[model samples]
Target: MMSEALRIAETFPGYSREDWAAMVEKALKGQPISRLTTKTVDGTEISPIFERAVGKAPLAMRPQDTTWAVCQRMDHPDAAKANDQVLNDLMNGVNMISIAFAGSAAARGFGLAAEKDVLAKALNEVLMDLIAFRLEAGAAGDAAAKAFSDVVADKGADAASVKVSFGLDPIGCFASTGALPADWAATLVSTIKDLKAKGFKGPFITVDARPYHDAGATDAQELGAVLATIVAYWRALEDAGFEASEALGMIDVVLCVEADQFASLAKMRAMRHLWALLLESAGVDFLPLTIHAESSWAMMTRLDPYVNILRETTACFAAGVGGADSVCIVPHTIALGLPTSHDRRISRNLQTMLLEESNLYRVTDPAAGSGYVESLTEETGSIAWALFQQVEKAGGAVEALKKGLLVDAIAKSNEVRGKLVATRRAALTGASAFPNIDEKDVEVEAVAPIALAVPAAGESCTPLKAMRVSEPYEALRAAAKAAGNPPIFFANMGRIADFTARATWTKNFFEAGGIRSLSDKGYNEAAEAVADFKASGASIAAIVGPDGLYEEKGADFAKALKEAGAKMVYIAGRPKDIMEALSAAGVDSFAFESCDVLAELIKIHDVLGIAPVAKAEA
Candidate 1:
């Protein structure tokens, strides 16, 4: 007897790739097939369709079982408070804790003090053997690790049962802060030897690519950095009396997961594939790769912060489905201040829902065997491998940083990303597009100021700057919020049905800059709109209507609004043919799709006598 899938397959003859292309071209109505393609920042081309081909190998596979640790970040400055939060998280669904030490690159501006007394107090009530612990202590990782070991000893837990990662990435610290505190060789050897002597049988070194990612490196660049950093660690460990396999077993990789779901998934798979290839080339047996993914800090925004929940949820889902061994979801309000207890709960529950309700982790390599994912994984891995070769030729990751090669590449990518954000090519829901002007400000607990570490004065290089794509738009919105009262007025030119769409668009556009827009209902006469515009007391007025109506009454309405004391007049639609006449009648500008929204908002702020505050440089 034939099964259902077998019968269905036999009922249809498979078409060739060319046959599929022909059908797609016909459906496109003579448009070129290339129009359906998109180019990513990493120089990879994504096509609308993909076909299975011979000799295309599958990427590395994840564990078959549905298991991934729900890791939560603990960075409260007070030891007791941090301990309380850790217990609460453990009592909930969280199974892993990542402690950020003060002055670590991963700490950003928040972490617990890295002292023995503080470490003991922070782990007082927690059972070290039951839950996994990962430390992000940057250059101070060795000290933090010793302190953590002391805490475990005090609790009398068997050291063999403890699972932890002493996240020690000296090269990462150098890239982040632009200074190497001590001799890299001495530090690496001493840290590893101390851990081995203490029977610490966990990942001791972290090859963190998050510094590069936060500094605006594309996916390929970030992967290249990770590979290069890992290779450097392997060489250092071998020199310090460890074999290649042992060194590889003692290291782990950390990657940043953002809101792009498919890209994030493919990136994780590509990293594993690249690692396998690297191990094969080094003549070492393959080992399962350990990857830790954290929600992207560069994607979080201070304005309309509630939208960050959606972003974090998507990132967490990607990390889980991408086969990350563990995932951390940063609080939605992290960019503003210390996250409140409620915000922490929201962040933890986001991963819980995705794991328990959505069952995202139930599938092993869910994207495998799909033509699109397979192609993406291959192309992404190839690009990263090539970049790794370039770094190797320039004398490894540290030398590449010292020579400013990696810094220059990251800067170029950052510039391109900034331009995209400015033009709204990269949309930020609450910060750059569709912002709520009347939304109340979010309150958060007060956070302590960062205590910066003093560098020990070795070789120094240019630091990679961390940036948020929405920061520019956020600055403009901040200015508008402080400018007081309604900032703009909408001059509806026709019946409700005629002007509603464009009027709504105009209102949303201005509101994205945090400018309150007072919209009037449909008005028949130019005199009525002019009267309403003057009564609203808004200096900036937008003319909203249909194309036919704009051609009919746009000129008169613009002239009347200027005469009635509107400092600046803007038309919602871009009627190119009548633009000359409209401008002559005092329509200063037009706002439409694909226009430079950030530039327009800045101009509007200038005209309204609102000066934006100086933004902090990334």
Candidate 2:
């Protein structure tokens, strides 16, 4: 093949790195180039531009190929329905299925029964030898694993040929549930020994990252946690008389992908690097480790679930592009309740389109050679390895969790990110930004939510509960619905054109906290606006206009709205040196970009006498 330089176009002007920097400085009006750079949660510095590299190497995939399993989640409570969905998915496009049992972290609150007869029914008429089963059971890991083993044994299938990931993750279970059936180290060793002895040639044990990831672990922390978990498990398995090669072969790696496509892709690829590094340090050959991904449940939103489809598509595509071996595309409506069959089909179709239509699985290591992504992978791996060493020094993931090191880290990071979410700094499209107050409800099945009990086995720690980014804002929206969508008067200070932009922004801004915007842009006089504000029946009001208009009539409008029985008054835009005057004239607060939106909304709820809505989902 001819190189690009060899066939260069003679008329095109070439630019060097210095030329680009000079141009950027001029564009920034003498500002430093560092202003264009940002940092990730792991403290990796990200530049706005990158130069082409002379030499780079591609990271190898598990099988040096791009084909991945189109896996769907099957969590219907009825065994017959689960079986029917499985058959339908297989018939349509899915070749793999994940069975999330009741009380498991995977399904949130709905899942199948963990019994042999029910398990058999769930697999009725399906060929075990052809289809792969990924288990999504938590704390009930023992019973669910044994029941599936019984299904494999009694169904006359060749256990050696059946593809199953039992997904017995005791460390992950303990992290989530805070209780293990017994001492976790011994339980895991005995369970592995028992499963291997049962003649199930398996990728039986998993280092599931969902618990820590959902609990708000950063990307580097997640990769580090995965590395630490794999090391801990292999050490235990080797001590239990399993060969290094055999132990490595028995392990499956699970991760979560979110809407941040580039970061998610880099995180997935970084896991592979961490896995290979672990093997190299152990003096074992690189083994095939199946990386299964579930699109992050913590990233899904109940308020605008159709937006969740967009999130799931981007996230699932990243998983495929980063060469995941299998992926479970969580239904868009799962956060609401048990998803309908149609909803399940929509999720399956999304994955199928990504694979067959978009051909995302056709290119192996799609992110391997790009300078930015390669550097991202390196930085992510380095920081993750550093954190993994810290975990090892603290006696690995289990000990770190017991001593509260990991949980504390999660707390500190989540607290920082929570402030971001609370303000408009971290804009959530449907919930905290431009929300759809009139969005019709998306229907979900009317199944009762399940509460799975995890029996205490004398060992316990503080559990890491899962959370979503949009929960706080969504709760306010739910409360607004209960309060009958009370209106907030938008007291536009000047003529329509002068106040349109700020008023529109104010409308979007206030509605984010579930308060509807009752805006009248044509008001030419403060007295007329006050009369309208009184007649509009809104208890609160915001004065919005251009800076000049705000300096002119903003204080008068605030005073008028308050005098017209508005419980609280606000003005948009932090115009310089006039906030004291506005506040004295009855402006209670200010609303602008990067303000504490959740806090302000909660205050609005209190002023409106609306009760706080409890957290609705489990």
Error of 2 at 595 (Å): 1.2
Model 2 lDDT vs. the true structure?
0.85
Give the worst 10-residue stretch by lDDT in candidate 1. Answer: 53-62
Evaluated with TM-score, which candidate comes out highest? 2
Residue 197 in candidate 2, Cα distance off native in Å: 3.2
Off by over 4 Å in 1: 1-30, 52-61, 451-454, 614-618
Tens digit of lDDT per residue, candidate 1, span 438-457? Answer: 77878777776475453564
RMSD (Å) of each candidate, 1 decimal: 2.6, 2.2
Residue-pair clashes, model 1 = 0
- Give one clash count per candidate, in the order shown: 0, 0
Report the lDDT tens digits of candidate 2 across residue range 1-618.
977688767657998888888899999999988799977766789998886544666567646545688899888899998899899999999988899999887768988878889989999998899989898788777789899988888889888888899988888888888876657667777776787788787787889999889999988888888888888888888888889999888889899998989899989989888888988988998886789988999998988889999999999988988888988899999888889889999898998888788888777877776778888888999988998999999998878888888888888878878988998777888998789888898899888988855757566778898898889989999999888889998878767888888888888888887899986666667898888888889999888888887788778888878878899998888886898998999999999888898899999999999988777884
Q: Give the TM-score of each candidate.
A: 0.94, 0.96
Can you give the lDDT of residue 272 in candidate 1? 89
